[model samples]
Target: MLRELRWLMAGALATTLAACSPGDTELLAPRATARAPGRATTQQENLQAFARVYGYVRWFHPTDAASRTDWRALAAIGVAQVRDAATLDELRTRLVELFGPLAPRLDLWIDGESTPAPGPTPQGRDTMVYWQHEGYVGTRLSLYAPPYGQVRVNAEGPHRRRFTQAPAPDARVEVELVPGLHLRLPTVLSPADAEHDGEAPLDDAGLAHAARSASGYHDLDVRQGAVIEVWNVFRHFYPYQDTVEIDWPGLLAQALADAENDRTVDDTAATLWTLVHALQDGHGMVGHREIAARGRLPVRVEMVDGVPTVTGTDDPSHFAIGDVIEAVDGVALAPRVAHLADRLSGSPQWRRFRAASWESLTGPRDAAATVKLRRGRRALEVDAHFNASEPAQPPRPPQLHRFDDGTYYVDLTRAQYEDLEPALPEIAAAPAVVFDMRGYPSNTHKILAHLLREEENADWMHVPQVLAPDGHIVGWDPIGWHVRPAEPHVQGKLTFLIDAEAISYAESILGYVEAHDLGTLVGTPSAGANGDIVRVDTLGGFFVIFTGMKVTRHDGSRFHVEGVQPKVAAAPTLAGLAAGRDEVLEAGLANARTP
Candidate 1:
């Protein structure tokens, strides 16, 4: 009987996981646990049930009560009230007791019982109220505004009456379809609260206090609430829900279970990190001050010959270029890299690159680090020091360097568009040009204008017009930059140096290049995530940032995990590092020199 109830609850949550399709019963199956009967598993199940309903009421219930209530406080209170529910009946009663005030029209019942009929539609209202978002970023500050216009159609037109009158709220009802699943049907229109309307702006101190005073820092309810809040946000608004291969219901269940065991702020952060990492979004991150402030070694590492090899450094006395790192502070290099990579979100290459570069080298500020290195068959132990902040790299090569062979090398990663504008004539006259894009670019996309012979409209980003819950895209707003022809069209061959570090804006420029065949891309494929980021603050003070829009190739094909692939594959070699050679740049130069 208990097993049957668990399966029913799983089915209910699965319906809410992604409303675009039927629930995957296999993926949502209850975990096979060998542990003795305890509250841990029960609390996980309870929270999962609570989260399913929480999303419906918080986003879909159009009432003055729900609009005006403090959602963060409600999440904490709801988690506390429902975490110990022993049966489906108890869960239904507790949900009603907690949400009845906000959602007077909410209905829940067992699958075998007769369901309640919806309230009668209000007179003289032909259209139902529902949510329509042009681009729902996130609510960080009441005064915070996006550069691009964000429109919430819920507060405009006939929907405005739903928030001011009780009958308008009572005209529509949210019902449970699969016993535990609570969602408004597609035919029903349920308006969301006005985006950040009437909310007072939170100053830094106010934000801190609000985070601390929300059921206390150590409270398990608060921890679980944090997980619930973040999970629901992604469950409903994440653009790549259909594109990625995550087990959504299982992910929520595991996150709630992990939150149950959280004892410290770091532990809670880890749980949140794990949740976000499953998205495979390069922009995904959990912001915690302590973790951000950790010290880093003053050297850059990369995978060379399948080993962690030092490639760049500010402190050469402790480590040299091409030195193979075997271990760090008594932990094997492979395990350390794996641990960091597991928590990072992105394509395989990007995750590995980031983990190897700086994340694995981070430790307490000003702490001593013991590193084991292999140099020319000699194994040596070296004591290294961590910097209080990210150590500055050695001075970059000239932004625009003219090679002896009349080839121009432009470092887009460091060269500002303003600085490069005047040099366009010089670059155009060169026999060939190599544009370095191994890292994020500095608004140099403007250069595309000079390379083009005519106007080109490349609509690469698709902003979802989310109307219902669970990321139902009613439509998409196609958006991208436009480029027009300018003076001094480059007669020289063009080549772009790229690697996994190239992401977001960098990928945008590369996407344009790929679409127009403007240049030959050299080096490895870029990070497979793109789109403007949206940062959502959780009740527990930790915030998560992820891609808020769907970015695609110029031809409108999928571009999330498949990033911009290179036409010519190249990577740095240990021997090249030992000899102070930039192999990727060399490859770009060679490609530029061709034809």
Candidate 2:
């Protein structure tokens, strides 16, 4: 089961903006060892801390002043200044400088604002230190109002303290009071705070029950729980956030209303699906579990000559390989595909592929679908019944194909790492090799090692870090994936064959290949959904896995929406399939064999 996470941190403004002040440090560096006052254990930790402060103030501050500021620019610029911070005090100084401009607008600073005299003092009930609304996980607040005597505080300062030990009933303590000023600290949710297991999580059946219940669906807790969870974790602004139009708050409100009115799980799923479509994210999924269990059409179809054609089928009624589908259930295939594009995520090519694929596999289960087909020059209509049974598998075992021309072909989906290990020497010595990535790969790293140049540092990936919990991408930080190819690195041309099915790990591995100029990419573009995914369970048992990071090529070009484009793009044609040819493979082979 995939677990959800909660972030605990405060937000603040940066103050290190003066020309006289030293420049910001390199926040993007993997490691930094500089030392100064108030130093965080690591530079990354310091950035995280800084981000928390920035976010807390920018988003949660009582006043709207922080909202008006250029926070994005503040973070971008402040990261550079803080890189040189040797101590926490030094980091604080930078923060003061960064926030200096907004100081007047914010009432957060203690008068004279200088660092408080080092250490503790006692005060009475009227005086408070700091206050903010407490945080919550799912629906559970972080606050635990234990028996009065159950907790104690280590007063670090008049306004700063730490939990020490359990206190006795009616325990009274004193702290030095700042004259004329004080702050109340609200119970804020800690990073370790978890969603309470109060109401048992709904199972699939329970989910269906909830969806159909007028009272349960309209219940505030149910609707808010779903919205809050998504708001806390969804990386809404990655890759295409700037281009995609999404009014997140508005959608949440609409979803709540829709959920209340929904009469079935499918209706609720459709509402949730709309929320995903708003972002145009390839990683978007809402009700996959229930949908996947619904049986699909027995035949496999491919987009050929811009038309969906039957490629293979075990239970052939009227459908046969090379039969071009013109329409389904009275709807024109092309127009239906175009209309469904909004519901699918990724680039135009990926959208087309998914839409066509969905149409090929979709229909009323146990009922017949009328498919209009054009087999060569003849047009025919047939009632095709979806296969309720599991799809059949090939009897012959998976193996690598070694051609007479000395080129090797391997379908990564069917082949394993061990299957390729024994042939590494010959594969390296061959004139060219083709890696068919038209399906999911069981492994990638080990095979990738054979293609990468040893000790090469390329801009291969990016991961988003949460500075605050606003349910949106705050920053996309570039990270490194250094390559060190195994002994006897392949000297021959490497060709990667990809299509709509090549996704996630497939697209990720392709990033390194394309970035380093390691091979030729032949075949249609990929699914364009490549990133580490974080799985989320909605109000009902519906599961959604979204891209948790922003991935890009070395050139900083995004791979999330615009998948790695093929150097030589080609699609399988019906004529080629009819003649028993793998056109995609042939294209790759031809490209490799050429000068």
Candidate 3:
């Protein structure tokens, strides 16, 4: 079962901003127009221009008209409206027509035209309204809390003036968005008055009506719009923008091109998958039910002795334990593994583990394929049936296990707080204890209380506070776990087992243990991705999930792709698997028994 992070931060600013200097207003001013390349020659180029302008107006423009509009529907309608323009002037007219209603102040012109001057600063109102974000995760963010806000700033107060605003709608400050297109969308304005703007605010009824009338994923235009929407969200709000090395603009161009050629929903999904894979984020996933429900081989494969070896299976007729899978469907398993890995997002170990485990053998639902396997000295060809339903697994062991030697073991992956609460006395009294974290854990992190001697606070996750466009993080609000000591402290020697499957909340617990020297870690490095997930449903049919916050080590070292490493490294071997031994767990047990 997947555990969702439910805690949310609600308060005023956590940090103070330095006073803005008069000269700092230049940061908000629009840039001068660049030399025009020529008219847009392709549909991709026109859509690219539309995407840039759409993001600017949707996120930065602060008018009530823009706020209440159904942005997803508008994106689809906008794509259909502007994608066929053959010249720069045509594109400009379409863009203005599409966005001018939502942002009445919006202006667009050809590159060589005369540039518009800045609007005069307001005379009476001392407060300026601008955007402030604590954890901007796109449209789906409202499900948790409001991540975006229109903050009121006093002109004479001590605050960062990173964004400049035009005083009124008539201001014509222009900046070049693409080679041939230039745009002017004011970032600041006076309070929106529907009567003054000559356009009534879109009520809930109108918003719903617009959404019903707009195009959906069935249309190629809407699919392209979805790509643009997703690309802009990551480009501007992803927390790890500085950590991950991604050619964002190039990626957007490629995604747009791929979407243009997409013939089926699956093709669009694959395109989106490739785009998210570049983040290398463990939490990143494309939410498509059909794709997710694809069939899987019955055997559980893992890298053992540097080969893809089957470790677990209830049906031995096809392949027994310790069988090396050399090829599937005539393709070598090595290249297939690499190909599957390339489409996933995560740290190197995590990606490789997933690719080698189940993804390499996955195919269409209820399909049968030939597998070439080596059982010891004999090579055999077998027909492997793909189970559309989840593969049957061995029965789970007791959550709390006890050995004859007075050592206690708990599988955090299987044990919840309720199950372990009754066994705390036995666990605390034992001479040694081992905790297995080889996979995602239930709500078992609270077990930390019994292991700690005092209150411990691990403030490792930082939520970005964005005040400007293009991922400009002005500040960060830290969020983390706070554990307090409880009765019946576990005096026994502690050991933890971990591997690449341990991610997010698992890493969070391990990070605390490593920082406080509370236990001994044994096994391979963890998955290396940690942070609460932020899921966004696009105007398109599907939704995207990704890390919403930035995470670091307790002492402020990089931890995005560098998960917690164990002091004692160990992995399963072919010999161990054939002998039915859990080598990693044995290693942890060995450490627990020492001293």
Candidate 4:
């Protein structure tokens, strides 16, 4: 009856394990006891069983399983069962009955069975445990560490710092917390021997064992290949290092660790994004199609009067326009915005623009968000569900607006500069022209060409060329864009309407207009990330987009971080928004009439 009970429990365990995805299991290196090729003792057999059972539970069970089952207690019972078995076959049968069908996934090899070749391990004598906790990174001696030992910790982020410790026999040293974007803990020690090699070189049998160990898991080979390729490509072509402040070695180490433990492509993509954002390059992005079309919250939150308020909503039943959000997922709105800002790449202005919206905080459809909001001084907490439906079409700005005062308004977001070819005659006839550059333009050169008066001065843009992998700027190719002598160009006063949304190509044009005194810029600062983008693909089917070219004005001043400065800085007031008044556009129109 006891034997039958054991079999019943084992079969139940198999059913539960089967429900999990193959990638959900924790992976372990193959371990074969180094002993003579003879019959194993009961004690030895039980120890081997204990190792396998421990590994199986750690990888296969839910992270919060301790509350559900006393895992250690189950392993103790299994160990006793193996020890009491009379023979090797009896021990194997006992393990098989205890673990059921899931026994094979553990990759455990008992005594006398060929052990797998050991993989590489970090060299050290002390036991080290490295982890990231609550935005802090640190390392300490593992619980299994020796009473007295030396520990050295190296942390790399925006800066570098090293800490060495000679701890008291009983107390572990507390590391001083220094803020950084990323952290690394090097010199993890092995408790066995300080000089002892952690892994032995593997033979063909070991290689086969490794492959078998990874059979059911995601293709680690492909992920590692992608990591290597990204490392190589970034080293060769990346042009802007001064703007990118990151610890590459530390980040790559974390990335490799993620590749080993990541369960899905989304998991890997998030890890890669964290690395890409470290550069603070606005073009830096890492994702796939699935991530691109991922669901968003059905509301748009805008920064109004320095407060995050619901400016629009797709689902009016759950949220209302004008509702001010106070917190997200129990975290205060300020801290949440700060945390999200860390995930984005750009200047402080650009980061604010990217993270100011509720869409930036949304995740997949199943990811429910808890939001605390205030409406007319009444505060309430609501569980907001994500919208799986396609997003509604955004309102398109007017292509061109003609005023009764003979002033022409050209919306750069909707109308390309080439679209202005037919309107040039009308533009030249007008007293003043307002180029609505509140958003990005399709082509910067096409619009800026009309503003240049001289042929030699037409060449205003310079792009960096890569000749070597050493990261030093090799050469610069000056690009010339000449305007046609069609109808004598617009000789009237020109005013550009720009704001935080004006970015990339828009800023490119703004820089040109500012350089040659071509036009007066009005409104808020532009998004600081500029230049062309370079896209890279990894073996794991993830793609990263980063700034590939270095863009500067004719005067050699940088457009990165230091965006186009407007002559008339203005933004919309809360009252203005409530009244549906375009304050920035009014400011631009005022500038157009300035003497």
For this target, which candidate reaches the highest lDDT against the unseen true structure? Answer: 3
User: In candidate 3, what are the lDDT values of residues 201-256, reduced to their tens digit?
Assistant: 22334333333432245566667767888888887778898899888778888988
Best by TM-score: 1
In candidate 3, residue 109 scores what lDDT?
A: 54
Runs with alpha carbons beyond 4 Å of true place in candidate 1? 1-41, 122-127, 139-217, 391-396
TM-score of each: 0.84, 0.62, 0.84, 0.57
Indicate the residue-level lDDT of 119 in model 4: 23
Task: List model 1 lDDT by residue over 439-522, tens digit each.
Answer: 888779888888888898878888776545655655677777878888888879999989998988899888888888988999
When 2 and 3 are scored with TM-score, the better candidate is: 3
Which 10 consecutive positions of candidate 1 have the poorest summed lDDT?
A: 17-26
lDDT by residue (tens digit), candidate 2, 9-125: 112222211110123211221122232233333444334344434444443322223435544334434544554566555554555555433332112222123222111212432
Of candidates 4 and 1, the better by TM-score: 1
Write candidate 4's Cα lDDT for 133-153 as tens digits. 111011222443211111122
Model 3 TM-score, all chains together: 0.84
Candidate 2, superposed: residue stretches over 4 Å from native: 1-232, 235-245, 253-261, 329-332, 363-370, 388-399, 471-481
Which residue pairs overlap in candidate 1's backbone? Answer: none
> Per-model C-alpha lDDT, please?
0.70, 0.52, 0.71, 0.52
